[model samples]
Target: MTLHAIRDCIHAKKVWDLCVPKRWRKHFFLTQDVKEWVRKNITIKGRLEDFEWRQWFPIICHNIWLAHNDRVFQGSLPSHQDTLVQSRACLAWSSLVLHVSNTVAMPCWEPPDEGKVKFNVDGSLDVTQNLRGCSGLARNHESMVLCGFLYRMPSGSILSTEIWSILWALKVAWDRGFRNLEIEGDCVVAVNVVIEGVGEEHPDLCVVQEAQMMLKQDWRVNLLV
Candidate 1:
């Protein structure tokens, strides 16, 4: 089966299993009711249900319930066909929440040796031609010593330059064998895109992908923008 099909199958099974628990159903309805009350009064998205309801109901029922109630709590109340879509969305949201929680909870790595290495990156763009330049600076926290500076002129759009700056900074950290490294950048968009793996509309996503691979290596790198 194709990757999409396989993933769908897994999500289906997960949603089904999640529905088997009686507690989940209770939580779903209770949360849904609470969310409805909130939406009528408050403007928050409200709390998400702790269970997956997507695989339990039919598509029409699912959509109708979602239209009338909060999707997370009311999602399982629908008919079968709609379950797959709802389940997949739930799974994706769950994964994102878990990832963000883990990322936030991760403690800063204590360097095996003394001193901390801070890497700062910045990008400049010429609005007229859309030409860009990226620069990165690495320094030691204790000594305030400038470890190195990386500069690159990326061809094409301004996005390419911002992305290249991050790639170069990561490369420098890997090469230097630094265990604890913090990266600082002024380009919030590039930093967030890299961290979240959300590539832009630009054609040069290959660079971003390559940088992501390098960043998955064994080291602690924090992005500060």
Candidate 2:
């Protein structure tokens, strides 16, 4: 059988394999008894199998195998039935990579001639379990352009969301090629995290730091509460 066929077999068995803990996967794969059980109980090929299932099998199987071997408890393992879970993870990973790329990417706006300044603004959503709302904005001093307010639904008070908004603003500024930017935000916590270089205190601040480094090339960041 081709590698694709083997992958299809692995995908077909993923639901059962997911129930088996990470520590047990290697043992399950290597154990002769388990293999016999799989062969007897799990059919690899048949007209009943759909083509989409075959296509998805390799991706799911590869992730499961990596999950088992890596054995890092970073977060709760998603359910096997969550076929799109890996796709979500891939999107998040891609966002992170794109974030990094955009940080170093060329300045979207040129630095204003001497004496001219560019401003970038952002807002935050501060909501508790019971309260929900968002606050932030961006503006450029050179262009005198002000960005509108950012809104959030219920359960938004978490610090991570604010930091994420700041990063988003930076990306916008970078895209506009605005050099000499003054970044403004309403979140004191987010501003202090960037100003004081307290990344360890707020693990999420790493994203802000990366954006700051990128902005340093042609822009200056100003934190406003």
Each candidate structure's TM-score, on Cα atoms with residue i matched to residue i, is 0.45, 0.36
Predicted model with the maximum TM-score: 1
* Predictions in order: lDDT: 0.53, 0.46
Worst 10 residues of 2 by lDDT: 46-55
Question: TM-score of the candidate numbered 1?
Answer: 0.45
Can you write out model 2's per-residue Cα lDDT over 12-65, one digit (the tens) per residue? Answer: 356546443455456445534544534532433322121232333344445555
Clashes of each: 10, 12
Model 1, span 115-214: residue lDDT tens? 5687766666677865566666555755332333334364656666777878877886787677788887657888877877753774767887888898
